[model samples]
Target: MTQTAAQAGRPRTRRAPRRLPYLVRQLGTLVVTLFAITVVIFGLTAIAGDPARDILGQYATDAQVTAFQQIHGLDKPVVVRYLDWLGGLFRGDLGISYQSNGPVWDVISPRLGPSVVLVLFSWLLTVVVAVPIGLYSGVRLRGRRDASLTFLTLIVAAFPEFVLGLILAIVLGIWLAWLPVDSTAVSAGGLFDSPTAYVLPGITIALGTVPYIIRLMRANAREVASETYVRAAVLRGVTEPSLSLRHILPNAAPPVVTALGLQFAGLIGGVVVAETLFGFPGMGQLLAQSAASRDAPVVEALALMIGALFVIANLAADAIVVYVTPKLRDAVR
Candidate 1:
């Protein structure tokens, strides 16, 4: 009777916390993280030099510079400017771009699609190519195949991303002539119309990212394979494929999923370099041009946008991890 009573009471004692409160806490953390990012973005502007001078040019008279500063609120103190900017953001106004004299969103909106496409293509391709090879390599650890694969990953990792881009551009775009040399056509035509334009850049990014993911997956798979549950399954005579796919893969996936979320965020920086190289009309290209022109508003908006994405990516990764891991789901609740 006592055993039955204790068993019945266990669930009540260990019941998961309310899901609403858990979500509310996550949202609060996201808001705090985004606010911190905005502060850092504004802080960077302090060292970006005088935006008024940059916009007005060195030959502009002092009176003209003062008028420009006054018009753009550049003459205001940093704190006031930050508050005004924050208020504008709350109102969905990203401010006018110094380079284009247009709403920053207008400039950013068109370029957003290309970057999204590139990131999706690159991430998906990396996962498709990396996951199977990584899992196989892990299952075959210490063999000649593993050594060769590891060596290749190291070789690829040794090259800078741009270097890899250059090589791909030369070989595939020039030598084989299989894909477009640059993404300029994609900018002129829509992505669907110039799908080939994505190929080189996408491959370049995939090659750059794959090595890290492969190594991470391999490490994770090996660790998971050694777990007691896996050993028990092995002793019970589970087939290799079932053991790897059913038992090992599921256990190994959580960290990889989190890494993938971070990898997506990290791709923003890589996209900048790739887009600039390929002449892709994306946020990356715009960011380079805006920074070069000292377009502070555009630059600041881009920085904050990227920072927000980073925070959101982490939150997303955490959510996915919690959803997939029963222990994590209960603990987080």
Candidate 2:
């Protein structure tokens, strides 16, 4: 009777943490952070230059500039202009791109899908390649294989994304002619039109991120492998594969998952470089082009959109971590 009573109470003590309140608090923080990002974006764009003058060019009369400013509500006080822009966001208006002379969304929406696919492909490669190497290094923990991997990952990590892309372009595209030099030849269908175009840029982005994930995953796996539970499982004569999958992997995954989430932001930056180098016509290339042209509306819209993506990625990661390790629930609040 006592054993039954104790067993029943054990389940109650380990009750899952409430997730709703934690998620609510995180959402609140996300809103405040996004609001702050908007303020900074709007302020920077406001002071950069007069968009009307830039768009209209040097020979435009004062009358023409004034009409353009008034038309875009740029003549309004800065605060009022910001508020109007903020309100417009809620109504799905991203303003007009000075470069395209069209709605900002219409110009960017086409590239959005391809950029997302690029990032996801890059991230998948990072995880698939990094995780196995990290796990193996951790299990080997101070062996020759681990030492060699440490050296190699560091060497790979040292190269900047553009430099790495350039090297790959030279070796694979020029020397061997295995793939096209640039994605310019790809049809309007984007990366899917010729999947080969994605190979170099995708590898470039993944290599840039893989080392960090590998290091973090290795550290976590090593720590988990030393735990009492893992030792006990070993004593029980568990097979190596089963032990790793059942014990170490799950225990080490939460932190790596969180890191992966943060890496998405870095991946976005990589996308910019990769797209520009490869002429992939994704958001990164569009952003670079717009920035060069001093297209304030397009730049501001892209900045906000990118910021939102970063926030959403982190939010999803946090939720996963909390779900996997309920101990983290209190930290969220």
Candidate 3:
């Protein structure tokens, strides 16, 4: 009887070992996120004060506004309109931009690549520069090196993006004469053709993000350095760089990963001010124009896209953490 029970339990334990892919878990999150997004979109549209009148003029008659509403199907019930929009979304149709007088994709797609390129470079720069600096600072906590880095980071973090953009523009663009000062000089059509155009904006955005990553990494590294395994590794003739790179980094990575993901999402939306300051033609500028013009379709589409990107970035980070961290995988299970 004991032998039979052990055999049965072995199979059960083996069956329980199969882990669900992160993508599957994220699919459920996406569904709930989309539902919430749809509700917000519907509510915003319902309470919106006359997109037609805003687009056309205040002097326009009620008939003109009513006609515009009918044309856009805005006169329909909120649920019906939301369903129609949702269906269109599924069919790869985000509907026309009321402001741009063009397809939503036509307006948004061209700008997406530039934003991606800029943010990707910024993220890369942050990781490359921040990780080492953070590690060194944490390792040399009582030294002048750490104190100086912390002071610089605090100063940088205190400045707003717009202020940073203007300062960089004046210092680098004018004083140093290295890059373009205005966005008009930067060609969004060929992002790589003018890498100089991205430098200012990327750095400006990175200023805000790098500090957080550095601080998080420093704190995590400090804690990690005190851990029993790390202390043992240090005492076992392991080099500081080796222990930090192999043990500390991998262990400290989860928070850094999460911070970078959230930062990327924030950059997507936060780029608006910097984009405006620099005159860079990206989704941020597009969304600003859409909002100013009361273009509900474009605004809604942009909002939804931004939300999707945020959710996807976070999900990707979670998935990465689960894949790389055995502890996280077990927790999920």
In lDDT terms, which candidate is top?
2
Model 1: per-residue Cα lDDT over 226-327, one tens digit each: 899999999999999999999988888778877887787677668888888898888888888888888889988988887787778778877777777788
Name the TM-score of candidate 1. Answer: 0.84
Q: Which residue ranges in model 2 land beyond 4 Å of their true spot?
A: 1-20, 185-187, 226-247, 330-333
Question: RMSD of candidate 1 to the true fold?
Answer: 6.5
What's the residue-level lDDT of 66 in candidate 2? 95
What is the Cα-based lDDT of residue 176 in candidate 1? Answer: 89
Q: What lDDT score belongs to each candidate, Candidate 1 first?
A: 0.85, 0.86, 0.81
Better of 2 and 3 by TM-score: 2
lDDT of 1: 0.85
- lDDT tens per residue, model 3, 157-224: 99988899999999999999998877655564467777788888888878778898898889888888
Q: Which residues of candidate 3, in runs, are more than 4 Å off?
A: 1-23, 59-63, 223-255
What are the runs in model 1 whose C-alpha is more than 4 Å off?
A: 1-20, 140-142, 220-251
Q: What is the TM-score of each candidate against the true structure?
A: 0.84, 0.84, 0.82
RMSD of 2: 7.9
The candidate, 2 or 3, that scores higher on lDDT is 2
